[model samples]
Target: MLKYIRPYLLWTLLSPAFMLLEVFMDLLQPQLMSRIIDVGVKNSDTAYIVRTCIIMGLVALTGVVGGVGNMIFSTKASYGFAKDLRSDVYRKIQSFSFANIDNFKTGSLVTRTTNDITQIQNAFSTCIRMLIRSPFLFIGGIVMVCTISWDLALVVICAIPVLALFVWFLLTKGRPLFMGMQQKMDRVNTVMQENLAGIRVIKAFGRSDFEKQKFKTANDDLCNASLKAMRMMSLSFPAINLIMNVTMILMYTFGGKMVFNGALKPGQIMAFSNYVMQILFSLTMSSFMLMFLSRAGVSVKRVNEVLNTQPDVSDGTNRDAQVTQGMVEFKDVSFRYPNSGGDPVLRHISFTAAPGETVAILGATGSGKSTLVNLIPRLYDVSEGEILVDGINVKEYELNALRGGIGVALQESVLFTGTIDENLHWGDDSASDAVIKEAAEIAQAAPFVSRLTDGYETALGQRGVNLSGGQKQRLCIARALVKHPRILILDDSTSAVDLSTEAKIQTGLREVFGDMTVFIIAQRISSVMDADRILLLDNGEIIDTGTHNELKQRCAIYREIVSSQLGEEALKA
Candidate 1:
């Protein structure tokens, strides 16, 4: 953080320097006014009065210029600091693995990046301006008052300890409440994100009222926490004002008696009163700044949490390992989700997919089928044992190189908002038009795509909401197909398409990518029947593995699934 400030060191230093200049000009005015009243007005000297007035005007102009300079430099330093911090935080998040992301969660990270950083930025600007100016004004005013009359200055000085104690109390008690408010802000953002993402489901199930209630609950929590923190802060105004007013009254009552006794001049008494107000005003501003500082302190801590966290999954030093053959092997691999206390999702799972072979994985829901294929790309590392790609440990390959060799279309097909051609280019940005159309044809997406008014140039809504479920799935597959990877993993990506379309896609894949190793995870028995080999998984372990006919004759689970999907007569046939 300090390193970022180093670049703007000139502005950082200059801001405070100008702020001190502004304070110096402010202090000079009170003494000048006193001389005008005592030496100029009392003696009825017009020349002396005019000369003092001219000097005061010049001082006021100088103060204005110093103020403008302070504002400029302070804004440059603070806004620049925030920009660097925000960019660094975003870069750190990009480096995070799936496990690292899970630890912080989306809502908290959003709050840290946005609201927390804003808070810190505002405080930093205030610190540069008020934090420097207030102390100089307060201490300078006190010194001027002491020169007027030590006896009267004592009354002003006596109020400092009491005001300091009260301010300290407010700040100490306010820090935790402010921290709680920031946390409630995270909860509110989380509720909002979940509701927006799942709004369709909420409306389909007629749960709008339920969602509204949930949002209200989160909103109220944030409101209540905000009120609690603000309530503590609100006390500072009246309390500091009350002390200021009392100190002023004391100065007037005591100093009048001194003037009558000829111990202090009438002009001195007036100047002393002005300086007292300046001291109190500076203290009041300081108190407000302290409250803001405490809140900013909490935000600083939250931002640092992200900056300081090292990613659990780091890049490998071995950048030269090339994946030649698409041979994938899971060697006694066991895996569990990070922070999940339950048993491993895949336990002692071992399998092998030779180059140029189509191996399909069939499993019940929650049987770790998707988890199995995810290991091939090193999306998540295994809890125990190792996964190898082309006989090299997956961890040993450079992440970009490892992922670049394989193309995956996940179970939930996601489409970005773009034209059909633009979305397809994600697989291979440099792919020619002929190559894109060929990949689309292989994924069985060309028919629907051609029917649209703009054909391949048709624009899509977010997540391809304009397209039907089957159409979206096909487009995702097409996107992956454009990569022409050495290995392809389709995790039930074809489930939404009709049986005929699915069969055509499988046939097209076999013809176009006959030599590429393929891993398919599917629930439909018909989907995996033509694979070179099939593995039946149950509860994170491989229950059986064989070709279609071989599994039907010997594996009870395989037989039952085939019977359920195709009927007993069809299986017997």
Candidate 2:
């Protein structure tokens, strides 16, 4: 808990000052009450009674001022802490490698950043304010009680053991229950998140009933865990209350006898009773604050675990030799996902692409085609070998310099909620209107974009959900083209576009990108048939490499794929 709160130390320190002022005000009221009862009410003096009543009212007003000041400091600190902590977590998440991201359940990450932070905030608000209040009242109450009668103060101390025992039980039994509750919340979040993301798949498969049952089990487990924690907490509160009531009753009987014997004045006995009650009240408050800290302790540990994970890919700053040209080479690069103890994704691979050449990789799914391209941008480190650009190992180049040379259209395209121009500007922020228009036209995206009511300024829904898959692909292509990167990678980006549009895009790409290097990964043989070089990959190895005519005569796998996709009549025609 301290780790999460440490960042906001300046405000936290300021927060206690206001609380101390509030405690001083509270102390004044109790002292004034005793004086009013003993000197004013019992002495038949109207002037003294009126004066003391006014003093008590002034103390209450001071308490109000202290409360307002405390709120100002606490709200500013808690909100600032929440905002900065969220930004820190989000930036840390972006640094994680693909393998590290896969280790976490998506829902768990969401819950930790959101719900868990709220829990910590609530604990902060309660603990800091009440923490000072409890301790001040306890100490002040003891001093006041001793002034009134030392004998009665000793009696109150006798009940201290009971309060200590109750608090001990709460801490011992409730901590584990709260920890289990947090884990249960994670499971609940996992099921809910999975269902939300895969709702379309669930509906398509007609598995509504099965999904409902799974959700029910997760929800019930969370409910049971929460109930168990509440039960343990309930026992502590009632036992403390019982001890407080019994202690008060014994004080009343003993003090009443002493009052009748004239050994104690009526005002002093009343003061003694108030002091004893205040002491017990502080003890009860301290117990509650301690309970909340236990829960926050668990939450802080989980949050810290995510923050402490070292990213597999490190950003290399101060890279002197940036990849100036589009030249790329791979020297026996290989990778195996940590969870899967199988063969590496790419084995004994060696390749080089000169500037101004089009290289195409054709393979079935899971042939490591995407993984191969991912290494170019240094998204993941190679297991055993090195990848180089411009004659320098990729790892030696800064991340910004290495990625700046390339523009990638991934297999899964994403768009933010903004006008079309805003999305396009992400590739190159200073692009002129003319460059955006030219790039959009070259990608064959202008026709549909022009049909929209607002054209280039048209607002898009999140993920471009309103656009057709083909239109979204074309926009992604245009965004990539606008940057004029030295190397462009299209990872099956044109699969959704019609053949006519695809041909037009290819023709346009040839004219403006004359000396640029392009790496095209496609399942369609037609997509890569015209490439300067074609490489057929299977099971992490390149099975064949040749031009279109050369592969048709010598490679059986290329021939079979061509025959199956286009058919004998289509191929012959």
Per-model lDDT? 0.91, 0.84
lDDT score, residue 164, model 2?
86
Best by lDDT: 1
Model 2, residue 505: displacement in angstroms?
Answer: 1.8
Off-target runs (Cα >4 Å) in candidate 2 are: 1-10, 341-343, 568-573
Model 1 CA deviation exceeding 4 Å by range = none
Q: Please give the lDDT score at residue 398 for candidate 2.
A: 78
Write candidate 2's Cα lDDT for 1-573 as tens digits.
456578778777777778878878876776788788888888888899899899888888888888788777787778877777777888888888787787877778887888777777777877667777788888988888888778777778889887888798889888899889988898889999899877878999999899999999999999999999999898877798899999888888888888899888888887788778889989998898888888887777777878998987776755686666788888987777766788788887788888878899999899999988888887778887898887888888778888888888888888889999999887899999999998899889999999999999999987887888989998999998998888889889899998889888888888889788889988888889878888889988888888877888888888889899888764454
Clashing pairs in 1: none
lDDT of 1: 0.91
True-structure lDDT of candidate 2? 0.84
What's the lDDT for residue 296 in model 2? 80
